[model samples]
Target: MDDRPNPIDRNLLGIYLNDHLAGATLGVDRARTLADAESERDPALADAVRPIAEEIAEDRAELLKIMRRLEVPVRRYKIVAGRLAERAGRLKANGRLVSRSPLSPMLELELLRLGVEGKAAGWRTLRRLADADTRLDPGQLDNLLERAHRQLDTLEQLRLRQVSTTFQESGDRPVHQESHA
Candidate 1:
């Protein structure tokens, strides 16, 4: 039996993989930036985020390996555009001009969490394809999917932690809340 994907299927797969690759690139860049920026001011957040950033980069590398296995050509322009978009995202106002806003960390964590969710979806899609595609390893996809789930859980914990840091006062009351009790 011929194990190769048909030409049309291969072409479509190439496009899909490249799109996800672009997103992965952006995710890696954003995760790294967030980790580095948080290092000094929020050492605990930095500690929590640094490993996730590393895993994100590793996941991007894994995607590249998967694309190579599937014979999908990397779209260099898409990668470049993804990087540029990540940089552009930094320009959005977080209610501060020069100094880093308290909201920045929380918002960045939320964005990273969303990216991981997308990545997990991609892993699931590939896992589904693995049943028919010999070039795709089900074991590898399973591992990647599991790691993505773990990353999602970690990001959520970090993001929720950021909520109080960003919005609450030293007394544990929300910044905007008035005394009622």
Candidate 2:
């Protein structure tokens, strides 16, 4: 039996980079679409969501830049897969025929919250690697981490408002129900 040192797993890094890149792309698309829908629904909400959409785009660009700096190739197939997944998400049986359901916004806000959480974890991982990889900057990662936290705060506020609006009592109780009064 011959024992030899194992080759470096270069594909692992490429896969990791591609996965995050795809995720960022998906996040950007979802953010833009949701921003447009919400803004159209209530013009006043535009003020709250417009900047978030812009920031998401900027973050996606940053991820691409990072991939470039690391010489990691962005997999086109992954981007396509991400787009398809986003499209499939809309097909879920939400009990609505054509019009948007009240639950849609709540589900979307939850997705955004989860995406932000994932982004924060990615930033933290990159920050850990910054000490070893000169291409990565700790400062930039720190800024991104902070921004993700702020994004979560904003998303949480929006989610809470949506929850209140979507699931609140309609004050139409059944005839069998006794009035507290």
Candidate 3:
């Protein structure tokens, strides 16, 4: 509505020229002035701004790629924690007597709280319990804790598998489907 290019618009064009010219051809000040003048005279002249915009967009894509690469391990950690919390909640509710494996309501609640807090050690303890073959005594809450931990580990593994597949697909195709058969 102002019919004038703002600092942000000038900055965007400046960034584009900087990238397209490899920072050698266009002076930032000159590009900014040009963008400002063009914007004031005719907003339609903004079409002349595309090359710079494209370059800036390419740079942004590269930065995002780097960010996601760094986030992979952190994402895995969150998924593991989330899974542990979910299993703990299930145990606390109706899963106590339903599971053949040991799972204590009290311990499950505690582990759930720990998982929500992002504690990896809590999930590890549950995993160890789940691996053991002996059936836990119904009276012992520790067994429930162990089973919950193990389930959490399994859930994390499953999440990783799904994520890996998604990464492999890379948005070129759909990753999930409803099975009618």
Candidate 4:
């Protein structure tokens, strides 16, 4: 048996936890600062920070997995934060558009079978469809539908932001509209 502890194992199981936590916190803090600074100087840079924050969050999760595999208990705070960070990363990956552009007839039929009807009911219906496999409770279904709606709202916000940026960049000139005589 090797009496000497593996340096890599010691580093990963010991110093790595402290360093990972510190690095995650510092990275997020620096990203926030950079975003604030760029908000005034360069909106693009501020937008860029969103992706950077997401990357740091992903890195943090990978580190957590390694810690878990080593039989080390990660702090509860870190675990919770990692979950939230993973969610944020997922939302970023999903992009800005929720795309409510007409469900397929088959999907619509499925929704009707699930007892959901009419517009604005698509999300709830879709949740029902998903719950078929996931076996989510009623409350869970409600929460999932709420999240879907929130995602749609995020898309709307992004669209509005893009429009505002375009207007500002175009010197506030209204787009040319043709009139039919």
- The lDDT of each candidate is 0.88, 0.77, 0.34, 0.42
Candidate 2 residue-wise lDDT, 64-139, digit = tens: 8887888888899999998887778878888788966668777887887888888888888778767667788888
Error of 4 at 166 (Å): 26
Clashing pairs in 4: none
The local lDDT score (0 to 100) that residue 166 gets in candidate 3 is 33
Name every residue pair that clashes in candidate 3.
102-143, 102-144, 103-144, 104-144, 126-149, 126-150, 127-149
lDDT of 4 by residue, 16-107 (tens): 46444444554444445445544544466468555544554554455455446545565656645644653453333222366211121122
Cα miss at 51, model 1 (Å)?
A: 0.6
Residue pair clashes in candidate 2 = none
Query: lDDT value for candidate 2?
Result: 0.77
How many clashing residue pairs appear in each of the predictions shown? 0, 0, 7, 0
Count of clashing pairs, candidate 2: 0
TM-score list, all predictions: 0.88, 0.85, 0.22, 0.34
Clashes of 1: 0
RMSD of each: 6.3, 7.9, 29.8, 17.9
RMSD of 4: 17.9
Model 4, residue 33: displacement in angstroms? 2.6
Model 3 segments more than 4 A misplaced? 1-139, 169-181
